[model samples]
Target: MNQQAISDLITKMADDELVLGHRNSEWTGLGPVMEEDIAFSSMAQDQIGHALALYRIQEEHMGGPDPDAFAFLRPAAEFKCCHLVEMPIGSYDFSLMRHFLFDHAEAVRYESLLQSEFAPLQQLARKLKGELKYHTLHADAWILQLGRAGGESYERMQAALDTCFPLACGIFEPGEADQALINDNIYPGEKVLYERWLDNIYRVLVKASLNMPDPAAITPAYGGRYGQHTPHLQPLLEEMGAVLRLDPAARW
Candidate 1:
């Protein structure tokens, strides 16, 4: 893929991290368990950090002026985050499901990108790859707990799985230039990455004794790679963008 295409993908992934980090950060003091509260909050901060790094790279490459300008000022429809990351955090179970789904997605994405032909992206990806391991451990622990909680917790987890499974599958949504990226070795083949993601996630879910999410015939509900987003994204943008939108040139 060309530099523009790589930058575009980077922007999309950065937006995904930023918005989801904001949502997870909302749980800072509200987790059902104190340990979970701290862990979730810390993970949120890490994601936001990664998002900022990618945003800086993107701003320099794509001539976006700066990272803070576009990230905090763009309208909701302009964000490049999939519906999987934009959904409201309904409950602890829902939050756990979201982490389980998206963390594995991140693992696969960063693993592939670590070997990217694009020099800058590869360097950044190599640095970020280590973070995904920690995220996977966190997701796995929570998933196991929820699965074996064996009461209201188990019931809630099942419900969350049903609600978020479709959205979760959409994390692997193919971009317009995905094939080009594969051909150019900017990323691995889509089939390989998708299979790896599915296998890794399913193994964790299976260990948690959860049934498969029946994703055999799933399709994407939203396509943020093409700038499509959920209605909730608007309000989220309003909150995150309020300061920057008002000031226009304020530095972060």
Candidate 2:
């Protein structure tokens, strides 16, 4: 990929990580129990830290904007995070479902990145992979714990998943130029990645005595990768961007 295209791709990915990481952090001290609270909070910290690292490279390549400003100043519509991450955290089940979905997706992403031709990106994957192992484990643990519950609890778990699965699926949406990146061998094949997602998730659900919702009945509320986001992002951006908007002319 050319400099501009590579910069744009990584910038978008970094921005997505930045926003979703912050959103997840909002759950700190609020998870169902101390273990979950700590687990999720730590994952959130890892995510935000990784985003900052990537954003620094984006800043160096793209020029002008610092990582913090780029993260905290963006308008709601400009962010590329999937709707799955921005959806409201209604209950423990909901948040856990979101975690399961994203962690699985990121597992695939980090694994693909581990094979990246770019030395910097490969090193990044190596560093982040350490934390991702726990992230995927924690998410799977909760999925098994909750998905195994009987009766009402089981249905509630399924209900939370039914709401988010479409958004989860959108995480794999391919941009038109993504193939070039794939062909260059800088990125992995989307179809193969997606198949892995399906096989892995199906195996998990079946093991947990759960069933995935029918695809024919599923439809995403928004496609944030394509710039369509939930109404929640507006208030989220306001809280995150308020100070940045005030001091756009000021240096910190």
Using lDDT as the measure, the top candidate is 1
Top TM-score model: 1
- Model 1 C-alpha lDDT per residue in residues 71-141, reported as the tens digit of each score: 88777767778898898888778888899888888889888887888877788888977788999998989
Q: What TM-score do all the candidates reach, one by one?
A: 0.94, 0.91
Residue runs of model 2 more than 4 Å from their true location after superposition: 61-64, 220-222, 248-252
Model 1, runs deviating above 4 Å = none
The models' CA-based lDDT, in order, is 0.82, 0.76
Write one digit per residue (lDDT tens) for candidate 2, span 1-252.
555555655765676576678778888988778887887788888888888888877766457378877788877777777777777667888888888878887788778878877656777889888788888788888788877888877898888878878988877767666777777676685566767887778788887777887766877444686677888887987887788788777886
